[model samples]
Structures are given as C-alpha cells and as structure tokens.
Target: MLMAMRYHIWTEGCQMNEADSAKLAAGLARLGYQEASRPEEADLAVVNTCVVRQKAEDRAISYLGYLRHLKEKRNPGMRIAVMGCLVGPRVDDLKARLPFVDIWARPQDFDAILRELVPENDLGGEFWPETFPEPRGPTAYVPVVHGCNKFCTYCIVPYRRGRERSRTIEDVRREVAYLCGRGVREVTLLGQTVEAYGKDLPDRPDLGDLMAAIHDTPGLLRIRFLTSYPKDMTEHIVRSVAELPKVCEYFNIPVQAGDNEVLARMRRGYTVEEYLEWVDRIRELVPGCAITTDVIVGFCGETEKQFQHTLDLLERVRFDKVHVAAYSPRPGTIAWRQMEDDVPHHEKMRRLHAVEAVQERIASEINAALVGTVQEVLVEGERGGKPFGRTRSNKLVHFPGEARPGELVQVRVTRASAWSLQGELVAAAAPAGS
Candidate 1:
C-alpha cells in the first residue's frame, strides 16, 4: 500500500478563515491527502492568510519567505499554495513577491484551487451543503453570506471578498442540520457583515427568519452571530434573539469610532447618537445580554478629542469585551490613497492602551458581577488542568467536571477575573438531548 501523501494548512485571521481551512482540509482529505502535524513534514502546504491588519499581512509575507526556504533547501519536491484575502486582487504583485509559490488561489478562486489539488480525483457529489463533514469540535461556523458591499472607507473586505452574496435559507438550514447530526451542539453564523444576510436573495429572508428556521433544528443547543453593523441590525433581529430558545443573547457590534465626524470619515454610515440609541435598545429589550464591541484607534486623521470620545463611549456602554486595534494603513484601502497617516506610531499605541485600560476595568467589574449566577455552559474542552466552556453569553468559564465535551452543564460562578471565570460544578446538564 502506498503511504498517504501529507498536506498542512497554516491559517491566519478570523473564524471565517478557520472555517475556510476546514473546507480545504476536507477537500484535500477526499483527494487522499492526510494532514501533516507540521508544515515542513508535508508534501504540500496551504496558507490561508488575512490582510485586514498590517501586522497580520506582514506575518503572512514572512511565512511566504519561510515556505520558499523550505522548498529550496529541505523539501525540494513539496508544493506550496497560498489562498485567502491577502492574495486579494493583486495576484501579479504577490506572484512577483513569492515567485516560488506553486499555487495562488484568491478568495474567489478556491474551486479552481481544489481542482488543481485533486485533478485525478473525480469522486465528488455535492460535498458542501448536504455532504460536508460535521465540525470535529462541538462548535461550528456556518457562512450564510460571503463578501460585503458596505465598503467602509478604511476596510478592504468588499474589494477582496466581492459583493454580498447570500445562500438561500434552505441551504443554510441543511448545513446546520448536517452539523447537528454530526454532533455539533453550537452554530455561529458568519459573514463580512452577517446582519446583511438575505438582502440579496429573492425571498428576502433576513437573519431573524434564518434564526427562527434554525432554532427548530433537532439537535442544535446554541446559535450565535457576530460582528454586526449597527445600521443594518433590525428590530426583528433583536427580538428574535430575545425570543428564540436556542439563540444566545450576545452582541458584537463594531462602532469604529465614537465621534460622529470620525465615523463619517470612515464611511460607517451611522452617527454617534444613533449608534448609542441602538445599544440602549438592545439592553432595554434583552436584560443581562453581554454586549461586545470592536474599536479602532488612530485612524488617518483622529484628533485628541475624537479619541477621547471613543474612551467616553467605552465608559458609557460598558462593553463585556472590546477588541481594540491601532489602525495600520493597507495598500488598497481608501484611507491609504486619500488620507494622510498623520498619527505617530507611538501616539496610536498610547491611544490603544488608554482605551484598553478603560475596557479592562469594565470587563473586570462585569465578570465579577457574575459570581453568584448559575450559567449554562456547553463544555468545550480542557485547559489549564480544568474543563473550560463558554456561557450562552459567551463568557469563558473553567470548572471541575467529569462531564464530557459537547454536553451542557450548569456551573455556579465561584471566582471571576477579567478574562475568565472559575466555577463550581452544579450539575451536568443534558441540553438539547446532548
């Protein structure tokens, strides 16, 4: 018997990248390639990269160099492929940079990439929606939509992933059902802007409708969505989370800046007052819901007052979690061509630290408040000699438990910190027939 040829995939960026890598892995497995534990050991390697942040893009560039060395010296016969948004529309530019790379698969050209990887293997019959494998872990990500049309001035998603294209509700429903049958208990819907799901479709089934459909699935214990735009978030979507049994009450809305002028410059499309009103509505409708946000500091022309306004928003909103980044100019963004990167690198870091400090205080207080509450957490896996899981509100919790992964458990919060919680096991929960 011939030994199976091995392949490895190095993935960078968001959950979407992870899901895409999973798809690639499945496709490669079908073509008789086993996953290698290390890149150097593989006969072929794929790198799925992101260009959202300059630092991340730089790392991807460095990895390309490393892959070139591996090919030239250690593994002369190894084939290397690059995929994902970092490849973007500048294929020739990237090709010039990495002339040794065997394949270049842009985000939109993955099918061709698959064909190149498995030219001899024709044993396929609709492997995506109906035949896709279940997530090896309990949680899975389902992309209801791909790409974006919003074209926020500082962003590159639209140019990279193309215009918004949504899968039909039936398609998403089947995918979620398949995942549930494969023992996945949780599903998080993903997209560049998930709140924009179904807008391009004929039937116009929005996210609320999609959630209601998936909420009726047999084995799914929890459902979640992420990184919503405040402008596109409808009342129906909010009410669905409030009313749906399986949907988690967690929101991750990114208000890029707090100052209206700054937001306008970023082409965010919503005013500061309008965004705050939406936040207030979510809190009013869904009490105890955990609200998380993403904030960027040092955009092209941010002033001291504008940065202060962001800090004030953090204080007022009291987000459960905040993902902060100092802006880095990317080659293709409008900010790169139109605006001056005037903020000193040190000033950007200082602003990042300042906002982080305020959010840290809020996070500590919020976690501490959960001390006596009983939280329903789906036991994910073990870490630090204890089992860790995330509450429905998306807080990380660790506790003493013999409960197996994929089962729900009630944990009484015993100790709390800003990043994670320690809990005493109350009882093993058999949620959704787990």
Candidate 2:
C-alpha cells in the first residue's frame, strides 16, 4: 500500500488566515493526506500568506522564495501551494513570477487545492475545493462572513477581499457544534468587519442573535470576535456582550486616526467623538475589559496638530494593546491613488515610537493597579520554567505552576510590567463563581 502523502501547512497573518488554514487542513485530511511534522518530510506544502501590511506581504513572498530551495533540497517532488490574501489578490502575478508553484489559490478555494494534492501524479494539476468542509481544532475560527464592505482608503482588504458575504446563523451553529464535539474550548467568530455580520444575508439575523446562539452552545468555554468597525458596533451587540457570560470582554477595534479630517481621508466613516462613544459603551457594558486597537501614525497630509490629536485619543482610550502601523503606500489602495505618501519614513518612525511610548506608560499603570488582585487566567502553556496564561480581559499573567493548556486558573498578581504581568497561583481550573 502507498504511504499517506504527508502535508505541512505554514500559516501567516491574521486569525482569519489561521481559520482558512484549518479548513484547508481538514479538507486535505478528508482526501487521505496526513499531517507532516517536518516540512522536509512532506509530499506537499502550503504557505498561507498575509497581505495586511507591506512587511507581512514581503515576508510571505520571501518565505515562498526560500521554500523553493527547501523543495529542491528535501522533497524534490513536493508540490508547493500558496494561498490566502497573497494569492487571492494577485494569483496571476504570482503564477507569472513563481512558475514553480503548483497550486495558487484564494481563501475561498484553499480546501479544494489541499484536497486535490493527494495523488503524487496529479501534483502538477490545477486545484481548488468544490465543497467547504467544517474544520476541527482545539480552538476554531468561525468566520460569520467573508469580505469587507468598508473600503478604508489605506486598506487593500476591501479591494482584494471583494464584497461581504455573511454565512447564515444555521451554518455557523453547525460548524460551532462540530468544533465543540471535537473538544474545542474556544470559538472566535471572524469577519473583515464582524460587527456587520448578517447585513447582506437573506435571513438577516444580526450578530447579536448569532452570538446568543453560539454562546448557548455546550462545551465552548470562550466566544470572541474581532477587528470590529466602530461604525457598526451597534447597541444590541454591546448589550449581548455585556449580558453573555461566555462571551469574552476583549475587543480588537481599529481606530486608524484620531483627527476627524485624518479619519475622513482614511475613509474610516466614524468621527473621533463617535469612536470614543463606542469605547465608552463597551466600558460601561463590560467593565475591566481589555480594550486593544490599531493605530496608523502618519497617513498622507497628517500635520503635527493632527498627530497630537492621535496622541490625545490614545491618552483617552488608554488601550491595553495598540497594534501600531506606520502608513505604507500599497499598489492599488484608494489612499495611494488620491493621497500623496507625504510622511517621511523618519517622521513616521518617530511618531510610531512616540505612540508606543505612551502605550507603554498607560499599560504599566494598568498593570500596576492589578498588583495583589486575583485574576482568572486561561492557562495557555509553560515557558522559561513558568506557566503563563491570560485573564478574562486577555491580559497575560505569568505564575509558577503546573498547569496544562486550555485550563483556567486564578493568579494573584505580584508584579506588573508594561507588556506582561507576574503572579502567584491561587487556584487551578476553578469555576468563575469560585
């Protein structure tokens, strides 16, 4: 009997990318491919690439180039596939540049490509999955929708990802039940703008309704969603999060610019006041929730005064984490076409550092306040002779203890830092009430 074709998949970029990878992996397994521990042992390799940032895109391309050498050295017959945003937007260009790539697929067709890679003889054939398969993992990323309706000027997501298409609540529930049955503890509801989930769907059951249904699912410990648009962060979702016990308090909302004019140029829809109001609502609903965000330091036409406004917003928001990105002009973004990339590299760097410094100061203060308080941490793993976990707010808390991944524990924070917290184990795998 022929040995199972070994498959190795390397995922890069967002949670969405990870989710897409899992789907592809599951689809491959159904097609009789087994997971390969080492890339060299694999008959097929898939690189799930990201294009959210210029650096990320550059890294993915560089990785593919490196993989070419790996293919020649190890499995000379190994078929290499590149998926995700990298290929979705530029499949033609990718095929033209890297002719060695056997399968180039988008997020939509990732599973089909993986399923088609089973036969060594058919490695060179074009591939794409005809049916979407529910994926299995300890944690699952359930994308409630695909694509972005919001075309932020600086972002390629709307253009490259196409239009929003939300899955029905029933479809999501079916996937969630499958994941739960597989012992998955966490399910992160995903979308380009998750808040806008179900708007385009025929049934039109809003995100809140979807969340309530998912939250009611058995065996799922944590329910979270991400990358919300401030414009669509409706009152209903806020109330749903506040009321739902299983729903996590952590929210990752990106307010690109603080100044209304800068936000206008970026096409972020909501004003500074509106953004703050959304934050206020979240805080009011979910007190002590760890709020994180994305901030772009220097967009085109950003003056020192506008930059100061950003700093002011940072001071007010006091985000637990800020994914700061300095603006880079991409090939075909609206910002690139209409606005000049006027901000010098040095200036952008300077502003980026400045914002980071402010974030450090704020986080330090927040962490300091937690000294001597016990917080429930979901144990992730051990590192450097210590076990580390995250609080309900997603704050990293480290303590010396013998605990396994996916276990919950309470830690009495003894020390705090801007980036992390040190604590003592108070309890292991205890209930929220206890």
Candidate 3:
C-alpha cells in the first residue's frame, strides 16, 4: 500500500481566504493526507491567494514561480494547486502561463481539488464536499458568506470574486456545532463584506439574526466576524453585540477614507459624518468596545485638505487600531479605468505615516486606561513560557501562569502598551459556559 502523503498549505490575503484554506485542509485529511510543518517537507503544496492589491497579485505569481524548483526535485507525482481570487478570471491563462501548476480551482471548487488529489478518483463526481468539517483542532475559520456586491472603484473583489452569496442559516449553525464538538472554543465568521450576509437568501436572516443563533450555541466561548462594509452596518448588529452574551464587543469596521468627496471618489457609499455617527452609536452602546478600522491613504485625487480630513476623523473616532495602506492600482477595476494613480509614492508614504502616528498616540492613551483593571480572559494557550488569552472585548492578554489552555481567568493588567496588555494571571476562572 502507498504511504499517505503529507501536505502543506500556504495562505495569503483576508480572513475569508484563511477560512477557505481551513476547509480545504479538513477535506484533504479525509482523503488520507496529513499536514506538513513546512512547504519543502510535503508531497503537495497549495497556495490559497488574495488579489486585493497590485503588489499582492504580483507577489503570489512570483511565489508560484519560485516553487517550480521544488516541483522539479519532489516526487514525480507531487501535486501543486492554486486557488482563491488568484485563480478567478485567468484560470486557463495561469495554467498556460505556468504549466508546472497541476490544478487550477476557484474558491468554490475547494472540495473538488481534494478529490483530485486521490490518484484513483481524479474525476470524481461532485467531489466538492457540501458540509463544513469538524476541525481536527481548536481554532478554525467559518465563512458564513462569500463574495461582495459593492463595486468599490479601486477594488478587484467584485470583478474577481463575483457577487455576494450567503450560506443558509441552518448550514452555519451545523458547521459551528461541529467545530465546537471538536474542542474549538473560538470561531471568526469570514466574508468579503461580512455585514452583507443573508441579502440574497429568502427571508433574509441578517447578520444579527445569525449572531443570535450562534450565541445560543452550547460550548461556544467566543464568536466574531469581520470586514464589514460601512453602509450595510445595521443598528440591529450593534444591538446584537450589546445583547449577545458570546459576541465580542470588538468591531472591525473599515471606514476606508474620511472625507465625503474622497469617499465619493472611492464610492464608499458613506460620508465622514455618517461614519462618525455610526462610531458614536457603537461607543454609546458598548462603552468599552474596541473599535478598529482600515484606512486607505492617497486615494485617487485626494487633496491635502481631504487627507487632513482622514487624520481629523481618526483623532475624533480614536480607533483602537487601524490597518493603513497606500493605494495601488489593480487591473479591471473602475478606478483603474477612470482615475489616475497620480499620488506620488513619497506622498503616499508620508500620508500613511501621518495616519499611523495619530493612531499610535490614541492607542497608547486608550490602552493606558486598562492598567489597573482585572479583565476576564479566555486562556488561549502558551507561547515562549507565557500564557496568552483574549478578553471579553477581544483585547489580547498574556501573563505568567499555571493555567491550562482553554480555561477562563481574571488577569490584572500590570502594564498596558499601545497595541496589547501585559499582566499576571490572578486566578483561573470560569466563563458562563465553563
């Protein structure tokens, strides 16, 4: 009998891609393949890629080229596949461009790729699995929806990943239950625009309804979702965070830009006033909610005043964290066709740093407030002799302790830095579920 081959998967891009990669891994395990610790140690390698920016796409293609040497040296039957947004439009072209790549599947056909890995079933019927698997370990990504309906001018997601499609409420519940049974304590729901979940489905069970259902789930300690579009954020979702026991108060809403005119140019759908109002409402409902955002600096035609508006908005909103990026033109997007990437590279860097500096000061101030509080934290695990966990508000905490992983504990924060809290564990405690 042939020995089962160990496989390695390398992922790039957003939370959705990470979830897709996890599902693919579970499918591979069902087909008798175990995970390898590194790329070179495996008989198979899969690159689940992202195409959000021009540089990211270039990096994925270049990385695929680099792996050609491994292909040449590995077993004659070693398999390599490329999936996610990178394989969307140019599947045939990518195959033609790099014939060394053995499989070209999109995000939808992840299960099919796993079946193709089986030597005797290269053409298995409907090989794609329908249900999310019970993960082999503690952490997992659960994608409640896929694709985006919004056609942001600079974004390639609408063109490449296509329109939004939500999984059924029943399906999501079953998936979460399966993961929980496998000792999974935490799950982050994934999507291109997660707030837009359930739009296409009949009866339209929106994000709030989904969260309520998940909150009722037994044995689930932590629940979170990501990449919410500002326009689709409903008041109900805000209330869900306030009311749901398991829902983390941390919201990852991406404001993108702060000026109305710049936002109009970017087609963000919400103005700076509207964004701030929503933030205000969130703060009102969840006082200690740790709000974070994504900011795009130097969008097309952004004037100095508009750039200052972004900084001003940051100062006002005081986001706990900000993911700052300089705009890069992507092929086949509205901005690429209509606007100019005239913002000089130096200017983009300057604006990005300016935004970062303001964010650093705000983060430091906000974190400093937690210095003497004992926060209830779900003990995640240990790294480098220190145990780490996440607070109810999703703040990361680590300290010296003898607590077992997955136990909830109260940690008195001895020190607070701009980004995270450092402390010592007071005593291991139980969350409501525990």
Candidate 4:
C-alpha cells in the first residue's frame, strides 16, 4: 500500500489570508492530499506569509530559514512553497533569496502552487472547490474583494497584491450558499477595503447591494464585513446594516492617524472632522452598533502634539474597540521612500501603549453597560470547555451551557470585561430573521 501524500500550510496575517489558506487547503484536498500536523511530516510544506509590518516580515523570514534547515538536515525531498505578500509582485528577488523554495506563489494565487505540486494531473477549470473539506467549523471567512486600489503612503498592499477587483454578487452568493450547506452559520465578507467592493464591476452595485443579495441565504445565520475606508462608508451601507437582520452591527473603520497633518502625510484622504461626522452618522443610524477602528502611532515625523491629537480623538470617539500599531516602514511604501522615520523606537512603543490604555478603559465602560442585558449569540465553539460565541454587535460572550456549535442561544450577561462578556445561558433561540 502506498503512503498518502500529506501537506501542511502555515499561515500568517489578516482574515483575507486565512480565507485564502482555506481555499488552497480545499484545492489540495481535492487533489488527494491529507493534512500533516507539522512541516517536517508533510510531502509539501507551504508558508503563507505577510509583510504588513516589520515584525511580521521578520517572522516569515525566520520561519523560512527554519524550513530551509529542516529540508537540508532531515527532509531532503520535502517540497517547500512560499505564498502571500512576502512573495510580492516579482518573485525573482525572493526566488534568488529563498532558492530552496520549490514554489513561489503570489498572494491569492493558489493555482500556481497547485499546478506545481500536481503536474501530472489536469487540474483545470474553476480553482475553487465545489465542496470545502470537513471540519470547516460554524464560522468561515469569504473574501468578496481581492487586492486594493487605495495606495496609502504607508501601505504596501497595492504594490504587493495589485489593483482592486470584486467578485460579482452572483458569485459571492454561490459561495455563501455552498458554505451554508457545509454547516457554516456565519460568514464575514472580507477585503482590504471591504466597503470599496463593486467599484470596479460594470454594474457598480456596492457593498450594500452585495449584503442584500445574500441576506436570504438559507442556512446562514449572520453576516459581517470589515476594514472599511472612512470615505467609502456610505449611508446606503449603514442603512443596509440597520435593515438586514442577519448583517451584524459592527464596522471596522481604520483611521490611520487622528491629526490632519498626519492624515495628509499618510494620504488617508479624510480629515478628523470628516471622520467624526461619519462616526456620528453611523451612531445616529444604527442604534447600539459596535464601532471599531485602527490607529497607527508614530508615523513619519509625528510630533508629541500630533500624537496628543490621536489621544484626544480616542477620548472623543470612545470607540467600542481600538486596534493600535506602531509605525514600521516597508521598503516600497511611499513613506519609506519619501519621508524619515524620525520617531524613536521607545517613543513608538509609548504612543502605542497610550492608545491601548485609553481604549481599554473605554471598552471596559462600554461592555459594563451590557451587564444586565441579554445578547443573542451564535454559539461558535467552546473555550475552556464552556460555550463561547459572539453577539450581532460582535462582542464575544462566554456562557455556561451545553450548546453545540452552530446553535443560536440567548445569553444573559452576568459579568463584563474589556475583551469579552461572561454570561449564563437563558434559552436556545431560532436563527435571526427566522
């Protein structure tokens, strides 16, 4: 009897990359490949990487080094493939640098690796598998949009992933329906700038239209999208969230910096006043909605006063959550080529922690308000042997209950924390909009 060919995929970065990895794994499964727990045990070892931050890039490089050593010392015939942003647009440099890597597939280009691995087979036609592999869990990520057009000065996505492209509503709907059949109850429509979806299509339907198109998916209990651009977040999108029962009342709008000067330097294309107006509009339209944001601290030439502006903005907004990152220049980004990274390393850390501290207090206060309320949670899975899930507002809830994954349950908040809610199971509930 022949031994089964095993493959392993090690992934790093955003939810988009996670979705990409799942798609690739599904493709590999269709080609008669079983998953190996570790790289050493696999016939093919793939590394899906990210270069969004210097730290992320360092981690990818370090892992590749390990794989290189492993191949030379132990697994001489092990095939290694490198994918994602770290591979970039042109792989000649990366190919030369990581010569041991048998395949150098770009981000979301799974066919490149698949073709290389199964050269004897005629694996053509639609790259996506009709049925995803087993153990897909109750929740899954679906990438509606690919790449990005917004070339923010500090961002390397456009350079790495190329221009924006969107999947048609019909195409997205098919995937959602297929995922529903596979026992996925919740789906998060993903993109670098999720709200910018449909701009490139001929009909230009927009994100609101896309959500409405899939609102009636038979088994899908919830819908969500993320990483929105402030300018592209239209009233239509907010209203869609209010009108669509399945769509979660959560928005992840990234305001790279709070000060206008920093915003211009980052080429974010919006002012602090403009961003505030959008936030106010969202709150006015969607009651009890959870608004999250991303902030980059210590961008090129960011002064103490400018950093104080960011602190003030956080205090003013009192966002439900804040994702803060310290600035690290990427080689091809406009910021790296044109400006100086004048902020010291310690100063960057100080600013990053300052934002975290303020946001922590705000999140604690916001969650504290929900202590006596009951949140309808789609029980995703368990943590520490207790069922855990997320509310429509995207707040994590941990409850004491005998609930299986994919079941909807009402959880009465018993305790509140900054990151999650501790709850007691009140009753099982029907899917939302049922």
Report every candidate's CA lDDT.
0.88, 0.83, 0.83, 0.90
Model 2 TM-score, all chains together: 0.92
lDDT tens readout by residue for model 3, 1-434: 98779888888888778777877887887777889998787888898888887777888888887678777866556678888888767677778888998887887667557656664555644454565655644456788888888899989888777889999898999999888876777778878899999999999989999988887677788888887888899999899989888788889999988899989999988888888889899899987898899999999999889999889999889888999999998878899999999899999999999999999999999889999999988877788999887887778888997876667789999998787899988876764335
Q: Model 1: residues >4 Å from true position, as ranges? A: 120-133, 431-433
Instruction: Please give each candidate's TM-score.
Output: 0.97, 0.92, 0.95, 0.97
In model 3, residue pairs whose N, Cα or C atoms come closer than 3 Å (at least 3 residues apart or on different chains), thus clashing, are none
What is the lDDT, from 0 to 100, of the residue 32 in candidate 3?
78
TM-score, candidate number 1: 0.97
- lDDT by residue (126-189, candidate 2, tens digit) is 4544334454434568888899988888888777667999988888998888777666667789
Candidate 1: clashing pairs of residues: none
Model 3 poorest ten-residue lDDT run: 119-128
Query: What is the per-residue lDDT of model 1 for residues 1-434, given as tens digits with 9 covering 90 to 100?
Result: 99899999999998888888887787777677899999989999899999899888889889988988999999999999999988777689878878898898877465656767655434664343223643888899888889988988889878888998998998889889988988899999998889999999998999999999989888889999976989999999999999998999999999989999999989999999999999999999898899998999999889999999999999989999999999998888898889999999999999999988998899999999999999999988898778889999999999986766788999999999889999999998785345
Give lDDT tens digits, candidate 4, residues 1-434. Answer: 99889999999999988888898898888888999999989989999999999999999899989999999999999999989999876689888888999998888888888878766545554354464434368888989899888899999999988898999999999888888887888999999999989999999999999999998998889999987999989999999999998899999999878899999999999999999999999999998899999999999999999999999999998899998999999999999999999999999999999999999999999999999999999988888989999999889999986988899999999999899999999998975323
Better of 1 and 3 by lDDT: 1
For lDDT, candidate 1 versus 4, the one ahead is 4
